[model samples]
Target: MTLQTLANAALILILVGWIGIRQLTWRPILVGRMWRLPIVFAAIGLFALSGSHGASSVTAVDAALLSLELVVSLGVGAAMGALATIRPLSSGDGAPDAPRFESRTGWVGLALWFVFIGVRVGIDVWAGALGSHLAASTGVIFVMVAANRVARTAVIGLRVSRLATVAPVPAGAR
Candidate 1:
């Protein structure tokens, strides 16, 4: 593996580790804030893919594998989001228009994260065996991670919105 590849792998592990810790704790579900990380990751992925040091070429097999990975990422991310536990935020803790729920992924979400990582690793191995370098590159991994996070955020946002619709409005706010 190249130095860049090693650096990327390390970076990914650090990111996942940091986020995993937060996922197990109760935190306010701020859909807007959730977007920043994915967007940054996507930008980095785009940069890597376009850089000379990254994947030089994309084969048909690479494309197919990437598509497959994307699908799996989305599926797993959605499952994680769906499994998240959301509780109403305490009074006076949020602004009138702020999100009312605090969400935690807990054990189940962590398990899903493992499943996602396992599937990603499996696909990467399969691609390497097929000589699809793109699949094994950092760029592809970043993109896939971004896609997964986006999927999770979307599902969580949907759930939060549903809750908002059904929840009674505070008397003062009305």
Candidate 2:
């Protein structure tokens, strides 16, 4: 439909593909692949810029607020990613067959990006500048995050169950 809606849909698809890639490969597709993430981010940025309502209404205060939101979201996401990355390593767990998905930290990065979209949508809505464009963009962000996390959780649960089923029983059996 609208450019914003299209952009949002593209972002959601990217996130889904990102998660699947991580789960199946246990690594980020971007790492030596280089140009991919940058290309995707650039495309999304261009889409957002093109559909944005313009900077006429973005006062210094609004800019500051958006900046703060971005910083906080990024910080939180980075912290989470770092924590997730370090957990298995620090636990002295034997090395995995392949490095875990933490190689690129894409999940946290995507979360931060969604947070930015949320703040932008909130600001636009508050300013009465929202239309179908903003609504669609925001809706896609929310839906994608929710759906992706749910899928991840389900996958994790299934993996755990499968592992338990295959693990050998201890000696001294009943």
Best by lDDT: 1
How many steric clashes does model 1 contain? 0
Q: For candidate 2, what is the lDDT? A: 0.42
In TM-score terms, candidate 2 sits at: 0.39
The CA lDDT of each predicted structure is: 0.81, 0.42
Put down candidate 2 lDDT per residue, 15-102, tens digits, no spaces: 6566545533334212234334434554555565455565334555545544554454445434434423311211222333322222
lDDT of 1 by residue, 23-50 (tens): 7999887899999989998999888888
- TM-scores for candidates 1 onward, in order: 0.88, 0.39
The alpha-carbon RMSD values of the candidates against the true structure, listed in the order shown, are 2.6, 11.3
Q: Model 2 off-target regions past 4 Å? A: 1-10, 13-17, 20-25, 28-39, 50-53, 86-174
Identify the runs in model 1 with alpha carbons over 4 angstroms from their true place: 1-5, 52-56, 169-174
Candidate number with greatest TM-score: 1
Residue 63's lDDT within candidate 1 is: 83
